[model samples]
Target: MRNKYAIVIICIVALVIIEKENNIILRVSDKLSQFRTLQMPETSSFVIIDDNSSYPDDIYSENVLGAREKGQKHILLMATTRSGSSFVGEFFNQQGADMFYLFEPLWHVEAMLSLGTNGTNSSTSPWVYRDVLKHLFLCDFSLLERFINPPPKDHVTPDLFRRESSVALCENQVCTPVIKGIFEKYHCRTRRCGPLNLTLASEVCQKKRNRVIKTVRVTQLDTLRSLLEDPQLDVRLIQLVRDPRATLASRIVAFPSKYQDWKSWAVNENVSVKEEEVKRLEGNCNNIRMSAELGLSLPKWLEKRYMLVRYEDIARDPMQKAAEMYNFTGIPFTPQTRDWILENTHSHSSGIFSTQKNSSEHVEKWRFKIPFKLAQFVQEICGPTMKLFGYRFVDNEQSLVNKSFSLLEEKKFHFS
Candidate 1:
């Protein structure tokens, strides 16, 4: 009877030990579950459903997330020189007090680096441009300071390369106080204000809800993959393209000194495909075509992030395109922005860099300006890019100059 009692006592002890081990394991699992919950982003929520019927009917629907209702947005307005980028950039710049706009910050980069022995080749490196842009987007101006020509003295520089273009930079708070009795009306804010206070600029940037940087210096789109994929930044890219013939025509007029050779060719009618200028044009078109292919492929990183806008499309209908862009970036279309667009688009002001113009008339003005031979040469070299972007080719000078002859096809480009 005592031996039987001993066996029962041993079994009871084994059961108690097993229960204790299970309790410990349960406690550890609970702690792990809490940790995972804490790791999730605050902006998103999770729900568990036990029944098959609980699933939403539109689970497979596209763009169900719609525009971002919350969170900060970073916008990059990407385009080439003389592609009507400055005009498009105004759509964002005119977004009232909430926007912090930077026009061609990379201008300083190119200008400073070209003075070095390596010339523009080193300055235009995608890596270097990307690093600078990353810093600027994060509201850090120290990286940009290195490239400022006069070397920002104590974080202040008078020559910031088109300081007037950004309204945020010209605000009374960011700029130094005007001298006593200085007529503010006579001089523009950029001139009235002393050297730009970068420290103050950074502070202003941090307070703003949106940051926009427009640049023509970034030549390749694939170079921006890392920036697009950054976890900390919600980046949106807008690529603006114009017809090669029109672009060449505008460049010739805007940059006469640089395009003297092209002007000579147009005048002399001695255009050749083998010329260095023609080869350069071919390279530019190829680069644009390659970038478009990458963006259109809809890579995992760029889904709902890349947008292609034709300069002609926006020029034809500024308000509609402006609204679409604002929707893409999740920025509200305010009254102030609409008013500015109304005034600028209808105005007759035409300066080399001025955003104000009769946009619809400006789109086709190049057709009348460029020679027929020059147009043909551009079409021959940029045939693939033109077709990709829906630009119609012309057969003769008469067709090119005909007001009713439309050069643009009715094609829609939307990524979202």
Candidate 2:
């Protein structure tokens, strides 16, 4: 009886051990598959793992690597018009990700303030605008409510409201009310209004996982220095620049009529400077000045939190540059993000501001479309800044006049 009992006890122990081993094996297999899906190329430049490391965790796990820290972070994308701000902004709005991203939330406010409409006064200076933006960045909608209370006249049309994050978040309890306020202020003018309390907007914003705000209105980095100093907010600024010649070429393509009119005025008047010339020149100079200020004037503590990205560089190798950006911002650049980049970039280049296309072909477009004399003029206007950005001037002219005409026709067809 004693020997039988011993055998029974031994059998039970062996079964328990086998089950534990099976569980361990399953977990190991699951982890391996996760890494396999990431399928990060062995030669990937942005891979966090060292070649010699035997385990993935030797460097850092996915959770600890990117923007998944315990506290909330505010990522501000700073760039000028047609500087690819939208493209960069989309990086944070990964497909199937829950992110609070505001696309030009200040647009309505600016329009209303500029027009002096909805009982607004002309006293709204840039500093006041900056302060309002600062509060909005901090998820304080109360201050923003004052500027856009009556809603701007242009808010409904041209689909400005459609581009906002609030529209995307209507189904979400956090964003529904805030969005409703815009429509409610205008007597529910559009069909997008939904039932929700707008008061909770601030609460939702404060606890959002990743609150990203992008603005092209800013011309100085110092204007946002206060945001960096805010203890409650973890802020990051991405200073995006493009080659000036390319920027000029794109502007011509987008506003061919405007440029042509300006050119005609210049020729007829025999004047180098037209009425809009100074404004355009100052805008470009201000962009360059902002770039310089961010690099030189910013304190060391704030400097570490800033990233300067070039449109040319990103266009050349988007994935690698995107990885670098994600790393800098503490946001995880996952396999899904890689797929998103590939999908968005692999297309024929387009000149229209609203459209996206073959990113690789976007580099050096100015060389083919912009005339040599005009290019030289742009170089003179943006000389030092161009040098600062390391963009070389191409003396050789390769005017694709026929191609430009064809492109303009296409632009008219699509945009007109």
lDDT tens digits, residue span 1-416, model 2: 99999999999999999998676545434433433343322322122112222223322232223433465667888887777778877777652344567777676556545544333333323444455455555555544443443422322222333333443334355323334234333222333444333345555555566677787776667655655655445678888887776776677677877667544543465645565675676566666655555554557647557877887677778888889777777666777768878888877756486435678776656566666666667767777777666666545454333333321111100000
RMSD of each: 21.4, 25.8
- Number of the predicted model whose lDDT against the real structure is largest: 1
Clashing pairs in 2: 66-330, 67-330, 67-331, 347-358
For the record, the alpha-carbon RMSD of candidate 1 to the native fold, in angstroms, is 21.4
Q: Point out the worst 10-residue segment of candidate 1 by lDDT.
A: 46-55
Question: Each candidate's TM vs. the true structure?
Answer: 0.80, 0.66
Off by over 4 Å in 2: 1-69, 95-98, 117-124, 152-204, 256-260, 263-276, 296-298, 349-351, 396-416
Error of 1 at 169 (Å): 0.4
Clash counts for all predictions:
0, 4
N/CA/C clash count, model 2: 4
lDDT of 1 by residue, 153-176 (tens): 888777788878888888877878
Residue pairs clashing in model 1 are none
